[model samples]
Target: MHSPSVSHRNAVDQILRYLKSAPGKGLTFSKNRDLEVVGYTNADWAGSVTVRRSTSGYFTFVGGFKPEKPMELHCDNKSAIDIAHNPVQHDRTKHVEVDRHFIKEKLEKKISRLLFVKSEDQLTDILTKAVCGRVFYDSLTKLGIGDIYAPT
Candidate 1:
């Protein structure tokens, strides 16, 4: 921010516009019959061309009254999912060995189960990606976010 560029200013203005358009939109939790926790994880492998870094994200949903069962975690990256389950370390995944071991430990203790999910169905995309129009609205609905002023 030492020397702001035109692109940065435009991006900020766009965000402000979106915030103004959905000032009352927010998450609305409701009670349900089933008491369970579901989680979703996704990673954009080598998403940044400049730094060649991957972006990973996850979300957990606590349903009903209490924790009924081990949380179900859905992941879109097969390699990351495999790393979490496999105890043997490999050269490619050595950098993330700590994270792999942590998730593996959780799996062994039955704290959570890692499951595969299609990229299109991953609800956390809204938070991690710059999506708009139908895709954006769809993700918001799946995340239980709605406009308070809109009629049900």
Candidate 2:
């Protein structure tokens, strides 16, 4: 089961609301906190029928504990992974020629790097599909969302 989340629906709106609603410029001085980044991503196996590309995205934030990029995406690619991964290219990859060339160039420039992640920990799936209600909530909750309460 998947639980509904306001954060997944409108990302831009979520960022704006977070910036506007957050208490202040974030506690840094006396809190003795260090800014850290946590990244996560997920991929759908051959999600696109038109090109047989996988839909995927990666995002980084301060682990919902500190202020950082808020909710900015580092990469959202449906057909670019093949370009990033050199070994994946074979006979079948010739179909998405243009995208392949472009993303390959980007990959060479250090613009992106591909990494493998397990399905059970693929947090991005919650946003990509209409999952069972409870399953969604459980995933998001485990990601330290909608449950963290900082005490004053």
What's the lDDT for all of these models?
Answer: 0.82, 0.56
Per-model TM-score versus the true fold: 0.81, 0.42
Model 2 Cα displacement at 36 (Å)? 7.8
lDDT of 2 at 152: 45
What is candidate 1's CA lDDT for residue 144? 86
Q: Which predicted model would earn the best TM-score? A: 1
lDDT of 2 by residue, 22-69 (tens): 444242323436454556666676786655857666555464355443
Ten-residue segment with the worst summed lDDT in candidate 1?
47-56
> Which candidate comes out best when scored by lDDT?
1
